[model samples]
Structures are given as structure tokens and as C-alpha cells.
Target chain A: MGTPLPRDPIADAQRNWERHGWGDVAAPMAAITAIMRTQQILLARIETVLKPFGLTFARYELLALLSFARSGALPMNKASALLQVHPTSVTNAVDRLEKAGLVARSPHPTDGRTTLIELTAEGRTLAKKATAALNSEVFGNSGFGADDVDHLIRVLGTFRRDAGDFTEE
Target chain B: MGTPLPRDPIADAQRNWERHGWGDVAAPMAAITAIMRTQQILLARIETVLKPFGLTFARYELLALLSFARSGALPMNKASALLQVHPTSVTNAVDRLEKAGLVARSPHPTDGRTTLIELTAEGRTLAKKATAALNSEVFGNSGFGADDVDHLIRVLGTFRRDAGDFTEE
Candidate 1:
């Protein structure tokens, strides 16, 4: 949804160190620290915006999963694995989504202790709308052209895969 | 510093939907949601590891910034801008970094209202050690290699400059 940083030539590197708490550190560390700091700043802004919609990143993730499904449904256990969260977290998230009327949980056809969570039509519609708004609200401000956005996705995708993201276990 | 995500891709998608409220979203929207999710997961994991050290991402960021600066000193305004936070967040972050004996603040040179902050040697040394540990924690898990770490950094770096960052007034 956004692009890279420092719209202006960045201020002094040494000054950045003092500000971010690296205080006279090297360039690499300074750069990393700055990234982390900016990351927090951006996420906080996104969080506040999503708050009014009753959506957290966690909830949004769940909805995305269901919408992508061919039948718009998946088993609870299956969803839990993909999110990399504990079963309990998945349970809680699903409960909230269900309450919001964004997803429906039905008895699993084949698995015990697992339910099938699917997006209702209304849920699907909301997800579509929110997706656009989320894009505009979070990254749209950057005024990224198609290529910039595409590059960001490809890079982030590589990053995610490289960051020791868990495979199905 | 990330927890293992479930192997189930379906649940993973569902998690996005539930948390972000997305359904039938475009690749761009899905991509942004995924990036945001990973950041949270990574930060949470980082917080867990750093907890025993009495540090958070914010603290680590400050320490690293200071460690990179000249004699570990810099002015206040730059800190706010580099960290991409309100001046107040910088103020509070420094207050904590100072109280922790990681940083110190002094009167700004020739400026009555401004201040300068610097990291102590203890902070600098500690930052190095903590970073080493952090690197291992990041690398030693999830069956990822240094190449993967490098790739991840590259991708994240792409986003770092690609855009979507908000500016402060």
C-alpha cells in the first residue's frame, strides 16, 4: 500500500543515530534502526485507521482467507495452520469474525474438533470494499504507480518467504 | 523474531480475511495485508526475545541509533524525523532510553529550547551484543539460511523505500 522512505534527502546520519538511540553508530545499524522505527510509526497509523472499522490485522487476515477459497470456506484447523497462530488464537479470531457477521462457521464434514468457516455474501462484499479502502488508507497516500506497488509486493513477498516463514507443519 | 505460522495456507488466507476484513481482494490489497501481518508477527516475536533484556523494538531502535551516531550524540528534531514519529514520541522514547542508562540528554549547543541526546558506552556495547543475539534468533530458526535472511532484508528494504510512509506535520 505504500512506497519507500525519506521524501527528502534524509537528514544527517549521525543525527539519526542520536534520535533513534543508536547514538553515533554505523551506517548499517542506523539504517536498520530507522526502518524499524518508521515501521512502527506506519503501523500505528494503520491501526488507528482500522480501529473504527472494528478490524485488526488479525481479523482482516481471517476474512482474506475465506474470500480466496473457491467455495469461500475452509476448515478451522486448516486456517489455524496458515496464520501461524495457535489454535486458540484462531478460535478467538473466528469467534469475533462470526460475531461481526463476516464469516459463518459450520460443522466440518470430515474433521472432528474442526469447523468450516466460510464468508457469507455480506462478508464477501464487505471484504471487497474494505480491501479497496485499506489500500487507499494505508498505501494510497503514497501515490504509488502500478509498477511501484507491484515491486513492493514482489519484494515483500520475497522478504516474507525468506524470513523463515513457517511451512505447514 | 517470528512465531511459526501454521502450514495450512487456507487458514492463513482466512486469518487475513478475519483480521483485515478482506474478501475477493486484489493482489495489491492482499499483498499489503500480508506485509502488515508479518511485521506484527515479527515484532511480537522480537519483543518476546528482548523481554529478558528489558527491551522492546522501540528501545532497541533508539539504542542502535545512538550506537551509530558520532560520540553517540545528536539533536532532538532530527530524532523525531528520522524515527518518523511525532516529536513527543521521540521525547518519551528518549526519556525511557535515558532512564534505562542507555542514553543521556544534554542542553542543545547554543540553543535554549532544544536538547541533544547521546547513548552511553554501556548502551553501545549492549546494543552490539543484543544485535548479535537477535541475528542468531532470526537466523537459527525456521530452517532458513543466511541467503534467505539476505533476501528478506532486500525485500523489506524495497518496501522501506518503495513508499506508503506517512509524514508528520
Candidate 2:
């Protein structure tokens, strides 16, 4: 990482927004921008942990999701929905994983039009190892304090729900 | 966006973690995953606003940064540092902006070894328009509530500070 800046760049950007007569939206702008930066920080950390396992965060998420499935498989569209990623992204991840012998695509038994993505034995093993590493190296020591972690989950949960990510039951 | 899921996927993932004997790390895992999902949601909104201007968030950030510079220019390295992105990413943004006639690069006047990136008039104008659109469509009505906005700013500020993004005075 570069040396810590003398000041928060987002704060400077917020000041610039205010100076430009955007006082009304400056805080939201800074908050949104902070989320972008924080995602970058967290993704970098997560990716580092997953790298040795030959996974990007996207691919790892797919593997982890499958690993949690009772049948160790899901229809492509269902996986896409659960992952909140585009179908094309799921397709691409499946392609990579299949090439790496971590997953396979098979015709859905009950639906000819659907394809099921099944985690291979190797995929399950890798997912377990990767999760263990992430649990220990990243999540177990996530940078946010305990209260901040709870706060983030609640706040971002609200934001996500507002964005139509899910409906609260 | 896809149809709203029946439940929060991150919450489901946290439960899965807890069931797997990762109870201690489950909350942090969910928090981080929520952040990842939140960033995706916000970025999609931001990108839609930026799309008509032929700008991505990265390029918009560079244009906005240079527009705020007193000279409408900054050394390329300094721009990267201030933006907290890698120098290669700054270079890539510069390449696209230059091709679009939005920014130009020149040898630094006093520092022969440094390259300076300056916003062209077009870049400045586009940045203004893009910022106005984002302010109106996204920032002004950010999915976050007003109180949540302030909370995000403070909470994320602490996280960023701890991550070495800045040294407060």
C-alpha cells in the first residue's frame, strides 16, 4: 500500500463538492465513495487469501455457495440468483471452474432446459481449505471492530434491502 | 436487477458458517460480504449515471480529481496516490481519457522525470455534467438514510483510517 496520505482523500473530495455548491449531496457522495474504497480494501485482502486456491472472490463465492448446498449443486439460473450476479458471470465462473476440474455442468434430471452446476470432489476440498484460510486470516481478524462489524451488517443490510437485493420476511 | 431474493443471501451464508462451527467469524464474514454486495449495488447505480458520458467510475474519479486541482493538472504519480489506486490503473484511465480527448499528458515543467496529467476543457466540462447527474440521481437520494449516511461516513472513516488510508491530524 502507498504511504498513508496526509489527509483523507474522500474528505478532500467532499470539501471540493461543497465548494462547488454541492453541499446537499456531499456527505452522501463521500459515504458512497468510502464504500467503494472499502470494498477495494476488503476485496484485496480476500483475493489474497483465495489466490493460492486459484480463486477470485467471484469464483470463490460460487464454490462456497455450492459447498453449502445439500446436493452440492444448483441450477445455473438459481445459482445466479442466489449469488446476485448476472447469469453471464455465473456462466463464466462455471466455465473456469469446469476447466480447472473443480466443477461440472450436467443436464438437470427433471428439466431438460436447465443445467446444474455440481461441485466436484476437488472443488469441495478446495472450498473447505479456502474457507478455513479466510475464516482464520481474514474474517476471524476482519479489520472492523466487533461493534463496527455488527453496525456494518445492519446498515448495509438496510441499504441492500432498499436496493431490492432481497425482501425481508 | 434480478427479482428480489426471498432472503438475504449474506444472512444465509452467515448461518451456514455458524452451522459449520465458525460461529465466531460468522458475523464478520457476513459484514464483509454485505460490503461486497453493497459496493456492487452502488457501483451499478453510479455506472448507469456515468454511462451516457462514456465514463466509468475510475475514469470519472480521475477527471473529477484533476478538475479539482488548482492548475487542473497533477503529476501522474501524485494523482495515483491521491486516488489511492495503483499507478498502472491511473495510466490506464489516462490512456482512455486521452483517447477521448478529455485529458492530456505532458512532461512536468520543473521535474523532468515526472509526467503531468491535465484535464482538458472537455474533461472539465464532462466532469461537471457527470457530477451533476450523480448528485441528482444517486447521491441526492442515496439508498442510505440521512442518519445512515452520517453513520457510514464515521464508521467507514474509522475503518479506512485503521487500514492506513490516512493519518489524521
CAPRI tier of model 1: incorrect
Tens digit per residue, CA lDDT, model 2, A27-136: 99999999999999999999999999999999999999999999878999999999999999999999999999999999999899999999999999999999999999
- Per DockQ, the best of the predicted structures is 2
lDDT by residue for model 1 over B48-93, one digit each (tens)?
A: 7778788887787667666666656878776666556678878888
| lDDT of model 1 at position B158 | 45
Q: What C-alpha lDDT, on a 0 to 100 scale, does residue A86 get in candidate 2?
A: 91
The regions of model 2 sitting more than 4 angstroms off are none
Model 1 chain B is weakest, by summed lDDT over 10 consecutive residues, at B138-147
Best by TM-score: 2
lDDT of each: 0.62, 0.93
TM-score of 2: 0.97
Off by over 4 Å in 1: A1-54, A69-77, A85-124, A135-159, A162-169, B1-25, B30-34, B37-52, B71-77, B86-99, B104-117, B131-169
**lDDT at position A117, candidate 1:** 92
